[model samples]
Target: MYKPQLNMESLERCVKSLEENENNVRDEAQKALLNICRNVLRSPNDDKTREVRLDDEVVVEKLLPAIGAMECLFDVGYVEDGERLFLPGNVSLSRLQSLSKLLSAVSESKPVTKDIEENSTAQKAFFKKISKDFHNVMHYEDPDLQKKARSVIPIAQLEIAAMTKMRHLQKSYKFSDARKTTSSTQFETELTAKDLLLVELLHWFKHEFFEWVNSPKCSRCSTECVYESVVPSTNHRCSRIELHRCEKCNIIVEFPRYSHPEPLLTLRRGRCGEWANVFTLLCRSLGYDARFIYDETDHVWTEIWSASSKKWIHLDPCENVIDKPLMYEKGWKKKLTYVIAYSKDEVQDVTWRYTQDQEAIMKRRKICTEESLIQFLRSLTDQRQNSSNYSSARKNYVIMRSLLELADMLYIPNLQNKNSNEIYEGRTSGSLAWRLARGEIVQADIEKNYIWDVSKYGKMFELRYNIVKDIYHVVHNDGTILEQKSGWQEGTNITNGGIFRKVENDWKMVYLTRSPQAQYGCIKWIFEIANSELYLETFKLRTKSEVFHGARVSWKIEAIFSDDKVIVIPVSNCNNFYTEDVRKAVKLNIIVTLSGGQGQTAWQHAQVFRQSLENIEEASMIINIQLKNH
Candidate 1:
């Protein structure tokens, strides 16, 4: 009799080694096991049934020991009855999920016995049931979407590569810090210079490549024309052309409504649809991840992925607006029904991002059942995944990650429980920044006077002020009296008098003041008076400060006062003054410190104030200031 020696400890060592060195060592170990099974052992009986039984016994006795030995080394607990192994903490969540699913699948495949024929029948039935359920949920029948998705595949690859290179190039340029707070700030933050290369390309295409097609001009007389009637497309290849007649020349002009992006690239202009289609295609061409965001209120835009931020930022090529998500709803005051974002890999209902009142917006959603919409999106996602060149595992990972991201966006907390009327009123109230920009003087009635304890940017400060004989007796939050000079009119002196006006049921005190030198500029202070408490919402200042090289410096300062106080802390020996060509430039270096009430420092920034004494003149600069309490 010949017997095979099974070294469980040696098998365990080899299995543990596979974790560190998987390829070569694992292959060798597998081969050695196979060779041992084939050459070392022999069947005891000559009967085929007995030989098969002996083979099964040999496999179970030899291989099962190795598996059991691995349990100790891997720290995995195995249950014999259920054939379930408790995975170690080191295993990933996805890996654990996959293993659990595999175990369930294997159990279902062999419900009664481990017979191969029965297992195969069970597997087929399971798959058939899954296929039926999938079809029932995903009943979308849009061939055009499928065709478009397939067409963009090659375009996406090339564009992604180009955008990657552009991002690298953009890293080399330095932008000014002053531009960070402007309207373009959101765009700049979302898309840096590197990101804007793609935007610039799109902008160029919009201006040079695309033409704005309105009414056609008369060919004979070169006169402006109006559309007389629409001539429908005769075939699929040709678009519907409009028959236009020139009012001045009495000449007819034919205008083709080019709907496709491929032809529109050459034909050049249609409307919002044509522009969005071509722009989206162009974005895809640069390898940039993009989506066509269709607003049901007859508008369309594109959103490109910002790799740096890991988010899709809004980009409107037609308006040259980037990352202005609130432009339509807040800026344009458009009531949106639905804002569906469609990408090659997925579809998302992103209406919440745009609309302030979700309840009002939901009332207008009458297109399809939510269930059917989800099914359509799932179908599109499936088609895209099928068309994707990535492996099954990679595609599945991407799909899962995307769904998680969408879920996160959909469940964000709604802080403002504002109704339709409140939303409208809030918008009309015009923020501190808006009123300051317009340099508007607003007045309100002061109901009563009381000292207000305020904090600006976490720095504690108390305002002591009262209205006496229609004149505001104002004092600084630090108990310092503001300078009220001779020949100063009430409400016109920045440090002294102010007028109040009613705004949104709150009294707004509009105070005017000038800098230490009127040549520097004038500052307007608007304080909101509510509950006998004064709240500084905002301040606007227009100042002409002297800089170096005889260059006059003009500054427009709009400061929004919050709960946190802005404290100017002077720094010793940091100030540097230099003269260039007899023009002195004073650079006042100080640390802008911010602290909370608990005596803890919140934030600090080093600020350098530069001024030139070359063209020192009374600039008549107007600064409007407004304050907001939150």
Candidate 2:
């Protein structure tokens, strides 16, 4: 005769209490025992009665022996009788699974059962209650969840969209996988630029931005410690603190579990909460509209908006995963009931996106009614949208569009029947063409022509002397032209020129050649007497302005001579002279001087002068000096 030592009703009640309880210690113990039972019964055999018998035998013979293995694996205690197992109110999922595996390995014998159908009803009801409680626990809402979500989502979006350091990161970490993967073969045949950018950003956030916190050494002995316990935080700065006991010296240390993202950024270390929070912030810093996803099963991650694909892509910073929503339920074998995502403009129930067993998930969602949940989310969304600075029509349109998107996700027939492109057009104009029309979100402004007031810097005018075959021509901005014999003669004067000034938005030339001392004869050299002080001042101002506007400015001097000869050179100084000695040494050598902001000055001489400026009939030859900003 076999009698159960553990009352199934008591265990079932404990599992049910797990859903309503807030105490961490009691909940952990219940979760551990329930997980062990789930793993033990999760065998491939479908014989319900045989499984029940095997489960009982396993609990008595194999499971009790496996408790020793769990004791070694984790800092937890357990008590067991013939059929019931009691835990020391502290257990982690990892150690639970480890114990369950050990039990399964030891209890390999098949159980014989004759009354399979008779026991099926009771077994089903017991398991059903356990499943319901487990689901309720998974969806249990944290008081601060909504607040954290709101703080993180919009900022994450801004971070990823505006990130300028991406190119450097891309060079170091190639996004080969991003370019290869398509969102869906049926709809999105190719990866768009936004898609690729999102993937790259995920990689950057995971590999470059965040790092895990290593366990601290023992304070007394300086030896590595094993994590032992956790105390839930009473205040807002942190969520909890973990206890680590040294293996060598029996010394205990406390490790604070942080919840804030700002401090975590500087500390650069933490578990999933810190990782997700900081990652969300980084995503927003780059200007990619993002959402902070809160998994009810004690995890968090990010989701970013893809304008090109017109969807939100899942990104797990800790796992370096992108667009794999089913990883939690399918890969991790997690039974999730709620996956809420929060953004600045909306609160969404995104659970369906991550889970495969929607029916089971819905059954466990007993905390709130569907209508109430929808109303709460809608109210939150409305509060956010109404608080925004957007115009009425734009706000309505955005809200309507968002609701349609939510409908599409929920498979509400009306909106889901329409193409995604149509929904996008409802928010924008017709078609998804507006995103393409907007162009790149973060592009550098192209440099354009800038007008510099010469009066503010130096003299607004200059003079030039050119020699054509048997022609000595001197030109000035004052509309004065002087011609002398081609050869230098005795008593010849060569000081005549013109001075130009900018007045009333026009260049007014004053003739200096009217005086006898300003007259010149047969001189074939160019001389410039610029104000060095003004040149330096103007250069500094120009460079400073360019830098302030995120640009660079450069100066060049070009000299045109008679007989269609032209010489161009770079300028870098306040005083420059084109002497005849150098001109003869290097035929057509022209001196160019430039002085501008930030102590930048350049002087260059160009020897090539094949192009001639003699085709012009005007007496004064034009010397074009160009200032370019880049």
Regions more than 4 Å wrong, model 1: 1-193, 235-239, 387-390, 411-630
lDDT of 2 by residue, 1-630 (tens): 011113332222223323333345433443344455564346423323112211233332332222122222222223321112333234333444443443343244322122223234434453343333223222112334434433433435534653534444454335455435433342232444455556665666566666654455677766545555566778666766777767677778887877665556566676667777777766665556777787754477888876655567888887788776766665554556668777655667888777656786775554445665667667656765676474688577666656656654675333423422321111111111111111101111112222222222223323232222213333334655533334211112221111111111011121111111111111123332232232211111011001212222223333333334555655442133222211211122222211222211100011111122342332222332222221
**Candidate 1 lDDT over residue span 1-630, tens digit each:** 001112332223223323333344434433334333232123212223111111122322333223222222122111110111122222223322222333333335532223223224323332343343233222122345334533534435445655776556444333656454544545456556447466556656555566555455578766556545555687543456656677766777787765455566556676566677777776665556777777755467888877667667787766666766666765555556667776655666677766666775665444345565566566756776787474788588666657655764564325223332331211222222222211122222222222222233222222222221123323454545443222112333132111122111011112222211012222132232232233443322232222332222222222222333333222222222211211111111111111111111001011112222222321222222233443
Model 1: number of backbone collisions: 38
**In lDDT terms, which candidate is top?**
2
Residue 594, model 1: Cα distance from true site in angstroms = 51
Instruction: Give stretches of model 2 more than 4 Å off.
Output: 1-14, 17-194, 213-224, 232-235, 388-394, 410-630
User: Could you estimate the TM-score for every candidate?
Assistant: 0.38, 0.39
Identify the candidate with maximal TM-score: 2
The alpha-carbon deviation from the true structure for residue 52 of candidate 2, after best TM-score superposition, in angstroms, is 22
For every model in order, what is the number of clashing pairs?
38, 42
Q: By TM-score, how accurate is candidate 2? A: 0.39
What are the Cα lDDT values of the candidates?
Answer: 0.41, 0.42
RMSD of 2: 28.4
